[model samples]
Target: MHIHPLITDSESLKSLCDRLAQSDFVAVDTEFMRENSYWPELCLIQIGNREEAAAVDPKADGIDLTPLLDLMVDNEDVLKVFHAGGQDIEIVYNLTGKTPHPLFDTQIAAMALGLGEQVGYSNLVESLVGKTLDKGARFTDWARRPLDKRQIDYAIGDVTHLATLFPKMLERLRRTGRGDWLDEEMERLADPSNYENEADLAWKRVRISSRKADVLGRLKALAAWRENEAKAKNLPRGRIMKDETLADVASHPPAGQEGLARVRGLSPAWGGNDIGGRLMAALAAAKPLPADEMPGREERGPGLGKEGALVADLLKLLLKIRAREGNVAARLIAKSEELEMLAAGRREGLSILTGWRFDEFGRDALDLVEGRLAFAVKGGKLMMTRTEHSQ
Candidate 1:
């Protein structure tokens, strides 16, 4: 529990980064606030190796992050480890315009090691390192100055526990001969394109109830507009317009300001303001989407009627059995929609059909669907059995 001094100045940060550069790998974590902002406000960055840990105050005035960023990018040999690193990587990518290379995400690694899908850092530490972390400062205002010692210790504890967790997770991965699986996962995490916030793709995040092409077109336009405006004004997307309001507007698009004002869940002031005008303009500019270009709905299974439903149910059982036997997360190998698609006999481009997933569960899933495999109970345990015809 030896907490190092908070690195507030460029000199200290540079010195710390230089010292960390000698390590083979470093565990990293960040504490940030993003509730009211378009981008996450990186308030504190915690970095540690096997021996010691330090917290960097990114909010400190005139504290240049170039040296830290340099250490992240130039030190290719040293692996940068994180747990559930999407947001952390997004922050670094937003600041430095590049994702840290040689990345290792413990959460992703945990899934490969059968811990669970998106395992929490605290859970990982408790399970592996036999320690529970203090989460009192989990929701504290990180942007505020003069952070208390407790808050600083909690922040540093994030990376310190990670320093212990990484080795054990890595050992499990190697013992299971699933290092390649983790490599595949890390490759996706390290891709900068995955972190880039493109405004045009913003519609994917909105949950629109209607499946109409025209409705989808308007929703896409409005969402894209909201994204660009939020980024330019440094406001959250919800602050611009709530997702429900977006859905409502898409369902029955407004022709003008008056119509916009009448929409449900929208305030009179919001609908009468400049934002309302932009929303009207977006809807007006939206072209009628063709049927082929309409947003695709999630597949529940083929139109095989009751039989399709039965197959989906069987697939669910098979997935649970396969996941348990392989000691891996079921959701990681194949999601519900993927299972539906498999039951419907549309297997192209499915994640389950390729890589380690294919070897683990995909083949069995396919065989079950094709009547080449059957489930049987033996010794009070359910197991897959080969059909005589298949044999």
Candidate 2:
């Protein structure tokens, strides 16, 4: 494949994007910094197909990225391929309010091939392309100017290797006929809700155990306020207020704006500040969370006791056996929490009990639960048998 020089100008980037747009699929990757800010600062975007690969500098002086952005989001004909690309997709969505569609993720695809859950790009490359990647520049500051040859080469290798791997992986998937299993998983990777960053729903990210309507209300309101504050300042949310501190404040709100100074994570000066006033107003506006939105104790389950725990463990063993036999990742079939939920006797809604997963593992799981299946030792190999003694 031909590798282009660093795309520091708009014309080169447009040409590169236009060429890539003609391919059936393009491999994509990005290098960005976000440790100091809420938003990811896109430093470089590397994109390519089997014919060519190039690294485009989004931060280059006066370089217009409109053509590349349009290719990334607007070009529906070309599929975008990435390995573990959640963050990359998030950055694109933040920039254009749309993720690259007709997307394919190798990391998720690796699960179906028994490469383990959430396979790293390096691992995927090594497994598919038979080469070990260099790690010297893995942690280099991507935002720095005048990136050396090593950095640029490292960045370019990401997509070049991916471009080579895409067709091979596709061919293998076609051979195994497990290609259909990846449709839902790939769709989920490109789902907008995964990267929406909805301020109103930010409270769900904070792990507070309280189910009280009033406390939850405060948490929801305060989380939204903090999200807006962080976005306005372009600072990390924790830079404004930590999760524990935010939860504490929500559970036990101060009497007035002056009380802000006494809060554990707040500065004494906050009592007299406009920020304090805004926080106070947010708290004042807090109303009880609606009944429908309140989480029940039985929902995610601490409700699974010793007996249910045993059942869940057996189900996990079954999952491992099935995953190994099928040469697929256990996590791709069902999560541990879902096993616990199933063991706890809640089965009305679960992905495991539907479609291909149900056909692959869930049916046997139900059989085991109802005493219709049992593990048996046969010719030094562990196997399952029908017991059909529903208990």
Candidate 3:
């Protein structure tokens, strides 16, 4: 096993970045702490190509990451590979205001290859490289200084296995002529807009059971306020106000400062402070929503009348068949919610109705729903046949 170098200084990091810039693709991973903070605190970054791997200590003093960030943005020829890369890319974007382009995500690729949906890096590495990763250091405090050899090795192993896994997965995609499928997935991943933490959009993250416009309006205001506070104070949103408390406050809004004090989970200090005043002002400022603009109950898909449940069950079976035949994961093709939507004849805005998904299983799903396709047991295998009515 080659011992991966630890780059802790500017000169070494620049040298490594220069070498990596020449590679066709680089596998990247990050270790960060975010349990107590609003933003992830990047502690370590592991990067590798076909030839070499290294762990860069982002916490090292006077170590500038500009060279690395520049290389990532400028080297359009070199592809960046990551497994479940959303958070890793977010950290990079937060630090440098740049998202790595021309990226490949192994977890997404695995789904396209039928390895299963949202496959973990360890599982993918084990399946592809026949090596079980040591996960003991996975939960370690990465912010602590003087990382042990075991910890370093664990970090290095992430990108090392990725370097090996990317080629094999890429080859599988090319051979199967499913490379375009990955391109779509990668495009979504590479988009910087996906990682932006816009405060106004933060309301979407809060779960509110009530669809009443008044309740939703209050919840939206409170969530947006909390998001702004958390970002400004550098604290977790839950630390500012718990989700349950936020929901409760939205459900039964306080009439005044005194009533605000009565809300559960709201601290006495906060209720009496400027935050409470702001909450009151937000509620006061909320205008009555138009009937059409009112929030509606969560759409579980159109109401399935009699026999709707049975059709949904059959759709599940069809999904499995299509997944197996197409060598792709069923969940990737259409989730249960999407299956119900298809059964209910609501195709607009559904992912299965578009792109590679449409080609893979959407057409047959529509056919099955419309009675244009039928399933038959032929030699113990379930076979799909066009219905006599269609013929």
Candidate 4:
């Protein structure tokens, strides 16, 4: 439970490698800052073998990570267990210039094993290990010197949980015959190409809930500007402009320097900054949309009143019922997007038709859609009732 610091000198890294070579799996986690730059600011990495968990201060001078990176890249038998591995893996690739091999992501595995998608580390650890981690220090600037005891303790907890959680998740995955599916997801996580950020496609990530075209243009401008600034300044996006404020600017489309002043969520200093003018210009330069391309972002998710809305709702209820019945996460059964798509006439991508999920919950989902089953409410609780000839 105590935080252990590992020596990062060449010899010590070699010693760590020797220990890892003997183990079948090692738990890993990273503490990084991404507020300033295009790449994640990797500050510290916590790695745990079966015997002890160690935190390596990567920012320390002359601390060579080649030995550790070599083991991560070359070792096939040692499973690198991580929770929410995406950003950690991205940092590893950024630092080592290589991707780790034969990785296992517990978050994704949890979903495949009937946990939820994008499950947080604390929640997963509580569910799997019955331990509540101290998270008060989670947002502290890890890149700062004279690291506090609390930050170090928080860092160590990340890797330590992996040792036990990995096996339990793996066992459930095996029992459910979803080991391959989990493997596919882990491979995707470990692959360096999967983490690449294509700035041009960044606009797709902007949420559309309360936006207008002018605002959309402003956001697009802000995003592009942020991408360039982060690359140029080597600072995180927030250091330039917070996304929430950018969303606001996009909606209001500042009329001018005065208009920019009126938009909320921006710092008072932001109006005086040079970037403010650039933001205004970006909004102004946006090509007025043709009618075809102007469809609002609301057109994105499952439409409630559409033909499939009732059926989709029924399927979602069934999914929840099945999740409760199976003691698995309801999100694992099917996502809202997939259910919406299925209800809207795109039936092919349904998990029910795929691998293990199909057997667990997809079949019932399709059955409801095909009129083989129906939904009703009893005493304020919704339930699925089979109407077809057979279950």
Q: Listing every candidate in turn, what is its Cα RMSD in Å to the true structure after a full C-alpha superposition?
A: 2.0, 1.7, 2.2, 4.4
User: Considering only N, C-alpha and C atoms within 3 Å, which residue pairs clash in candidate 4?
Assistant: 35-236, 36-235, 36-236, 37-235, 37-236, 215-250, 352-358, 352-362
Model 1 quality (TM-score): 0.93
- The list of candidate 3 runs beyond 4 A from truth reads 1-4, 289-300
* Cα RMSD, model 3: 2.2
Candidate No. with top lDDT: 2
Worst 10 residues of 1 by lDDT: 295-304
List candidate 4 stretches off by more than 4 Å: 1-5, 34-39, 73-76, 96-99, 111-141, 148-154, 191-194, 209-219, 244-273, 280-299, 302-307, 375-391
Worst ten-residue run, lDDT, model 4?
288-297
Query: What TM-score, computed on C-alpha atoms, does each candidate reach?
Result: 0.93, 0.96, 0.93, 0.78
lDDT tens string, model 2, 41-68?
Answer: 9999999998899999988999999998
Give Cα distance to truth, residue 127, candidate 4, Å.
5.9
Better of 2 and 4 by TM-score: 2
RMSD of 2: 1.7
- TM-score ranking from best candidate downward: 2, 1, 3, 4
| Candidate 1 C-alpha error for residue 135, in Å | 1.9
Q: Give the Cα lDDT of each candidate.
A: 0.86, 0.91, 0.85, 0.74
Model 1: how far residue 46 lies from native, Å: 0.4
